[model samples]
Target chain A: MNLEILGYSFIQKGLIAGTAIAIICSLMGMFLVLRRYSLFGDALSHMAFGGISLGLFTGIYPLWTAFIVSVLGALGITKLRKSTKISGDAAIAVLLVSGLGIGVLLISATGGFKVDLFSFLFGSILLISTEDMLLILGISSGIIATLVALRKQLLHLTFDEEQAQVSGINTDKLNYVFVVLASITVITSMRLVGILLISALIVLPNITAIMFGKGFKKTIALSVSMSVISVVSGIILSYYLDLAPSGTIVMISVAMLVGTLLFKYVNVLGKSHVIQKLTSEA
Target chain B: MNVLEVSDVSIKYNGHLAVDKINFNVKEGDLLGIVGPNGAGKTTLFKAIIGLQNHSGKIKLFGYDEADYQPLLPLIGYVSQKVSFEPNFPATVSEVVSMGLIPEKKLRKGAVLLKNCGYSWNLLYKKVGKDSDKVLECLKTAGLESLKDRRIGDLSGGELQRVFIAKALVKDPVLLILDEPVTGVDADAQNKFYTVLRKINTENKITIVWSSHDLEAISKLANRVACMNRKLFFHGEKEEFFSNKELLKTYAESAMQMHMHDHN
Candidate 1:
């Protein structure tokens, strides 16, 4: 491994921004996965594509438009699920298809900004400007602060929403707040892992950590560690291999999940073997 | 003295009235059982009293009006019917119980939550922590001290119920509300659950308002019973509720309707 590869300015930027996005997305993902909204992340990211296209067509900053559209999309999904007969997954499906269609139409309408569209669709982490790094840091800190301040209330609502409401939690307001935060989280993370693989960052680490049966705090800690390892290592490896950074990161996350499952299986088999040996000796 | 005063409370869901003009008063330390068929508004009445749903009319707890009930929520613990969570929620018995103390500590004591949840205070000297002794006491009272570190999902239905009871008791609530807590529990587990609730009510002197469809259990355990089918049918002593043939018939009819709906 060439240690000097880390000396590149783009590499440094990618590492810093990617690390920040990884931490927040992993934390946010734990709740999303637990609440069974794993696919919502994917849906929102796709919707963010449409937002990006709209931004391009209107000659505005794409990320800012994405931030708005994704938040609105998240809130819309929540409201639709609650108000109509549409289930959560169904709502996500509707949004996912519509988002892609709109993205395609806007891209064509804008005379095909292929280079810009490609950069957004698949993340161009190497092209992350200093301002993007600052934005990522600011958003990550805000998300972290909000989660810390409302940790207990969020836990109550996550574990038992009805009981939380009964305990005087403003559940309706909290739901909106949470979804908006999550939407912002999804949008910010797209720069590091791209629209396609953003949900992987949001889901894979937490699900892997859950397989270990640790308590909530421990699970969260483990997930964050896993996410950091995946992001940092994937960034380094992709630099060395000259591959797509987002794909590399998502693949590493998937690998980590599979590794945990295999380890659990092995552990179970080893325990059963030990039990059998003890019985024979007796 | 009445601990819970609910008067002329009505709830409508999607423009259909679920609980209509319901009025019931539960005295301190009374074990009041609410029995009704599905969609009979027993749950709605409970929801209204606990401030989970919007309703017309008034509810007073400890003589305080509805608007002021938020501060007193820690004093009122509720367990909803068929409460389900993520199978791998990653909460231990102690951790889940600690959540009950958050509202209390946040509202009254303004103490750092790490202590209230039973983390060692030595790690953070300046942070005022929850009293570990009080948490253990609540766990002991609910017979869940032995399972404090065990994951809640690993426990049996009866054990989980006890953990929830301990969770509620951690706040030192004067009132405990349970909705069909034993509905899916095994027969032996159900009996044990009732025995635990009886202890909590009679020995600890905590007023309990539980909703169930178990007529026999209500007759055996509750001092007072309320029957309902959207509107309040009867609310009185257990003997009167059971002995009144007309009320019993109404309850039976509601149960029959529920069974028919299930079949359909």
Candidate 2:
């Protein structure tokens, strides 16, 4: 392992971008998983891809376009779900397929077929520019600040919407804000993790954290820790094995989830013994 | 003066009229029990009052229009039939109870309300306390003090129901609305639950409006009763409401036929 390579400019940028995406995605993922909106995150990521493709065809900044499109997609899905009997999963399925279809159509129509969409499908940490890095930092910090300020309201909405509303927490407005925040997270993470695989970063770390987390705040903290560990480890492994950084990062997250599940199983088994002993004594 | 007044309120769901032209007045400190069979629009009425559903006509709570009560929501506490909480939702009992205070206090000040609910400020400040004093107080009120530290998912159906009621009670609302609060619970638990509810009404002077299908429970517990089947059939003193021949006929017909078939 060349210790100096870790300090190189490109590697440093990749690490910062990777860490920022991990933090934001994982934090948002905690709420998403709790609310059973994991598929919404997946659908929004695909929508961002469609936006990116459109931006590519028009020769504009894909990030801005992707952010706007994903937010619109989130709003559209929410409205559709509310006004119709369509299940959330069904709605996401529709959005995902249509978004992918549009992306493919636009890419081919613009004669950008040879533009290597595979890079966006997987990811290329080496391609992250300083501008993209700054966007990631700004988004990550904004998300953290908003969450901290609205922690009480967010926690209320997440746990019980009706009760939260009865207690004067504007659940509808908060839900809209939550969806928009999720859109930002998906768009910000698209550079490091790619639109196709962005939700993996958003969901897997949070799911892993939940197994060991004692409460909502702790779950968020653990999720950020897990995300950072996975991204850094994945990037390091990718450097050594010559693999895609995003794939390696997702693989690391899956490993962490599996590890946490095993640890939880052992803990539960140990507690059952004590419970049995107490029951017998009683 | 009436604490709550609903006049000719109707609710339509996708072109179907769930509740139609219902009128009622709930006096201050009234323990109003709403009883009707399934699909009788009892829950819809509750939802309409809370602004969870759109309805025509008018509703007033504490002399203010329902529309104006958005800011006064903290004065009203509601427990719905749907208990839909995340099974592994991360929060201690005390933290969950403290959520009831979000309307009354800012994040930091809400911690003080949490302590007032019976949790120790010191223990709450720590990672997780062993069911704070405030949490235990709520549990004791709901008759689940022993299960304070247990996760909401780990509770039995009856205990979970009580926990929801406890959550509502911690807010100390002037008006408490419960939609089928005792459904799916054992007879003993139901009895105990009603006793707790009666004590809260009589001792603490909290106003309550609960919906239930148990006529006997309603008769025994309610000072006032409202009967509804898409429209208000009766809304007055429980004795007068139950004694009305037409109202009794509506409720008794099904039960009477079931009894006749059983005897045959």
Candidate 3:
């Protein structure tokens, strides 16, 4: 091993951002995915794509636009679901298409898809500036800390909204808080997988951790650990293999999910074999 | 004070009346068992009272505003008709019960990023175990102390039902609302469940509005009876509600019609 990549400033920044994002994504994504709202994150990221497009078109800081657009779009889903007869997933679909549509139109309006927008579409982990990474770090810390404080309420609402509400928890407020955190998570994850694959950060790690069938807190801990490892390993491998960081990160996370499922299958197989042998002997 | 006051409350589904002009009230310390057949709007009525379902008219809980249930939440604990969730979601029995004790007022705090900075972590994770005496006592009441550490998904339906009851009971609310809470429970457990309910109603004076299909349980346990078939068919003393053969016959026929309509 050359061990030379560790000295690079970009690699250090990527590592810091990757680890922070992994923790926040796993924490918030667990709640969203479990509630069947994982796709809501995907849709919000699309909305962020539109924001990024608008920023690139207007010559403004795209992160600010992405933050504003995605947060507003995320809240729109909640409001639409609450105020109308439409389902949450249906509301998400409306935003997803509208975001993607507006994004393409904006790119065309700005004289077609520019190279600047593609970096955000596919992520540019190696190209992170000090300013960008600092903002990401600040927002990521805020999201993680907020998640920690609202931990039990999130789980309570996730488990049973009616029970939580009757217990005197204002569930709608917790829901808004959850969506805002999820939106911010999508916004900061731009440098990791950009707009297209951002939900992977939230969903893949959680599915992998859920395979272990651990209890609630343990399941979250396992997800964060898995996500951090995948990100760290992906970045290191991308450096040595000359691969795309965003693609590499998502591929590694999916590979972990497969690996966990395989492990559980083999464990079940081994237990069954032992039982078969015992019955034969009897 | 009346623990719950429902006046001229009506609920509609797709422009058809589900609960029409239902009027009733429960004084503090009263244990009211509401019994009605399928599609009789018992569940709908409960949902309206809790502000879950949209309805017309007024529902005043603990002297709070009509229809708005936020302030009354701290004083109320409820078990909905559908008491379940994502099976694989990681929640333990004790943790589920401890959720009830998370002060309703504390939970109503702002959800802004830095607004809940003073939120206590210990109140959530540390106390969410067998360590909390209230959780243990509630679990004990439900005969589920041994299952406190088990994953809720790993439990039987009956056990899961008790876990929810423990969650509802852990807070010791002024008003306890349960809708068919003992559906999957065995007879012995059901007997014990009612016994605990009776004790709480008499000793703690926790006003209860329990809806059930089991007329036997309601007849034995309820001091007040309410029979519904899309409307308030009867709301008075249990003896008056049960002894009136003409009223019972009318409700029975309406229930049969509703049951047949459901099948159709």
Evaluated on CA atoms against the true complex, candidate 3 attains a DockQ of: 0.52
Instruction: Note the DockQ of each predicted structure.
Output: 0.55, 0.47, 0.52
- TM-score list, all predictions: 0.89, 0.86, 0.89
- Per-residue lDDT of candidate 3, residues A1-282 (tens digit): 687888999999999988888888888889998899989888998999899888888889888898898899888888888889798788999989988888899988989877888888898888988887898899988988888888878888998887777666778998888888888888888788788888888899998888777778888899999899988998999999999988899999989988888999999999999999999999
Error of 1 at B188 (Å): 3.0
Colliding pairs, model 1: B115-B130, B116-B130
Clashing pairs in 2: B117-B134, B118-B133, B118-B134, B119-B134
Sliding window of 10 residues with minimal summed lDDT for model 3 chain A: A161-170
User: After best superposition, candidate 2 residue B35: deviation in angstroms?
Assistant: 1.3
**Candidate 3: stretches off by over 4 Å:** A278-282, B53-58, B62-70, B104-131, B184-199, B202-205
User: How well is each residue in B39-99 modelled by candidate 2, as lDDT tens digits?
Assistant: 7788878887877788899998766776555554565678887778988886655567666
Per-residue lDDT tens digits for candidate 2, residues A231-278, read: 988888888889888889999999999988988899999999999999
lDDT score of residue A123 within candidate 3: 87
